[model samples]
Target: MGRGARETVLGTLGKATILQIPPELQDLTRRFGEAVWKRDTEDPQRKLVLLKYLDGNYTNYMQERTRFHKSSFSLEILNTSRQERQLYEFIVSKGPEEKVWQIQLEVYEPVSDPSIQILGWALVNDSCTITLNCTAERGDNVSYSWGSWDTSTSGLCSHNGSLLYLSYPLQNTSIACACTASNPISSRVVTFNSSECSYEQRGKFPRTEHLVLLVVVPIVAVIIITGVFTAAHLAMPIAKQEHLPLAEDSAVHTIYSQVQRVESPDKEPTTVYASVMMPTA
Candidate 1:
């Protein structure tokens, strides 16, 4: 038969075999070719070409199209939505022999900034604890890490999962902190001011100072009041007495009476004398 006639027959046979393919299989095949072709446009020199087999025997056709076969097939998917599992079938002798293969294309977006929250903290102690949670709208095998960034240094602490617990000293006001979310495909980082997670170092005087004031002030006040009462008690006189005597002498008589002053334990006592006279009848 002539070459043209042989090609016509082969084409007819190939079409009939394709018509017999299941709808699902046909869809799979079409999607595979489309994905490969889209990849080819970006790099025409690395086009993917499938082998054309002869009669249902691999031995007969294996060597015939060695030069026509592509080195390998690769698809570059820019968009994650476009990634999918693809099927391709290689037919020999118009359908008597066939081989099927699949290509799995996975495209994932980079992780976005993680959500951060302060669980609790102690400012006076200069310690803070925070939680970093990372998530992606479309990604798999995501991971998280925590770190501190300052003018002096940047250090990272690794954690295996999406959530990370970070506890660090908030010693410097200039330091900043961040969480990094990553996947096998890509990574992203989000930063925050350290002050956001830290407590205001309890001002100059903390709760301890207030507590000291509460305990010390009353004691001091009691001491001052006691001192004042003791001083007043010591300054006042204990007692006072006055006496007058009458004598029956014809002439005037003078008698001296001694007045004694009581002394405090802390002071010396004082004394005074008064003269008394009696007129006789």
Candidate 2:
């Protein structure tokens, strides 16, 4: 940390009421700090127990030690509190100009699982882009990781990380996503289902656009059908037309009979007359 940041942290630590630190903390520091470098210190359980007083993760004892002075040690409580977690610093030095072996300590609680949320989404053409988040109820010293969206893992729908990139035909289908929040002490997982997200949005057009199409398409069809019939009627050829003649001034006209043909050449020709109307004017 920088000097300014360290001083700022120290300034904050100074504001809290000075509660007397437990004397046993120094003894605990001494137990581990003094045994930094030695030979034949093979009592694994004893050393682990001693280390646990500061950090609980030291389950087994391993001799990864170097030259440490058991005589010169100073235990400094960098920051502390009675009811809450605290930070400690154990500094072991041989002399003013010598190397320093410092161990900073802090208490860690089990991480709580973060909640997942669909941050936002966009639909463009045949593809959809969706962003996700798992910051809600964030855990201490947390990390982020996302699960796969495939069938082998029994996951739902496409793509990686906190963003889901899905293809077309998303109707009748869904996407299941998993986001994990983890720390050294614990890990948590949160899942999200995009089925409902893509449920109402079945087709390319939304419900409102579909409604508009429903109204517009039929009107356009009716206009096209009407135009087709009109063009056909206009293109057809009209046959020659004739109307029967009407008598003038309500006068009756002469009637005509069909001509009779002679059976032999000697037979006389038969005369036939057709009714003819003459104009009064």
Candidate 3:
């Protein structure tokens, strides 16, 4: 039989090739065969050899270690897009299985790098606030610890979900922040200095001044205007010379009385006629 045809038959039977053929397949079935000869040999759990041909410069152990670290195997097909179930069924229907067995191959792709971010930072009024942020590959959990440069204090304050914020009063002096994030396969450290200080004013000037001026300016203006009006009303005016016009009758009486008091005795009484003169051109 042709190689491809033979492979197809073997694969259908679940044996596949000479490398995976059991010793019992070598024995021929006969009616006269003794019990010992016919005894079924336990198929040593079929060992799938993952052959890796490294370059000339690479060592055997290194290749093995790399394969182990990456968790790669011919049977262990990586579901890159995680569409393994669909791909498995499609490949099974294509051509002969023996042709597929002739190809012994696998590819190793490097894993993604780790991601680190500063999610948030907290500042305590009297103490120090320590924080940490790190994310690993999906399905991987990160282990971490916190420590300061000062030997006086160290411990796991608390771990809330993905955030780590702590206020330590004991080690309030000049200090540094350091932490190690790790998984089963890898680990890394992140640190920062306490000397980096920053400042901000949180209160609002517009709202505060708006409220104060709203209450004070009107009150002061009203008091000033009231005091000015009050002083003007209370002030006493000093007296000065003011003339009054006399009435015609009163003027005549005053003249007669003056004449009666006259001291001329030897003179005869004389009649006097008063004439009013008109003003003319």
Candidate 4:
């Protein structure tokens, strides 16, 4: 009827122990009481369920322990009537107490899948093979399987264990490598791109450029060799010519002049000098 009456009846009922309150309903009543009275008593108070139903519906209540602070309580209804279908939730420290009344089951979220890293790479023949290492990020502990790329062509490879395989034909391509992780609640996928691998890069050499360089190198070598041989042959004659002395007699004869003397001799005979005799006794 009212708060005072309800408390009195509860006290009397407790003393007689005549009413057969089911263990579950009794726990609910106790939680309800704590949530109410604690709100009326303290600065910061605890909260509890105020009402519950099997169908999806809920009501909430709040009571302030002090003028400035309050404790709150809520009740949520799951739509399903199935007894087996339970919702899991976390409660502040009093798990055992809350479980008895609320019937709130504990549930876990699905774990995230495992991811891989390329530790090393090797080129076999013309094809490239990658070595992978992996780690799992999970809610609950899980194991992993690694495998080669599947027919579906999803960037991911099937997993047998952490060891997986990927084969790329000797060509240029962006290949996808994937790792899958699963747990009871959920599964996740992680992929490593081929480009991330150190040796995964395919280097290309131009066929035309290679041919051009090959042809040019020998031609240059021949030209250099021919030039060296010609210089060696010419140097011998030049050295011999440098060692020979110049003729001095040939130079004097080149400068001398020859005279025809007939007329010129007559003119020269006309001029004679007189000599004076000195007295001797």
Reference-based lDDT, each prediction: 0.45, 0.43, 0.35, 0.44
Mark the 10 consecutive residues where model 3 has the least summed lDDT. 84-93
lDDT of 1: 0.45
Winning model by TM-score:
1
What TM-score goes with each of the models? 0.35, 0.33, 0.28, 0.31
Candidate 2 local lDDT, 19-108, one digit each (tens):
122334345445443322111124433322212222222221322311122233322223332222323222222333222232322334
134-227 per-residue lDDT for model 1 (tens digits): 5545445567676655535364344556565656677755656566777765677776565665454444223556768988999999999999
- Sorted on lDDT, best first, the list reads 1, 4, 2, 3
What lDDT tens digits, residue by residue, belong to model 4 across residues 93-168? 2334432322332233455657787555556676667667766755444556554364554534665676766656
Writing each residue's lDDT as its tens digit, candidate 3 over 175-281 gives 55565555544456555444432333112222345668978999999999999998776663322224444444453322221223334788766555454543332
Better of 2 and 4 by TM-score: 2
User: Clashing residue pairs, candidate 1?
Assistant: none
Query: What's the lDDT of the predicted structure labeled candidate 3?
Result: 0.35
Model 2 clash number? 1
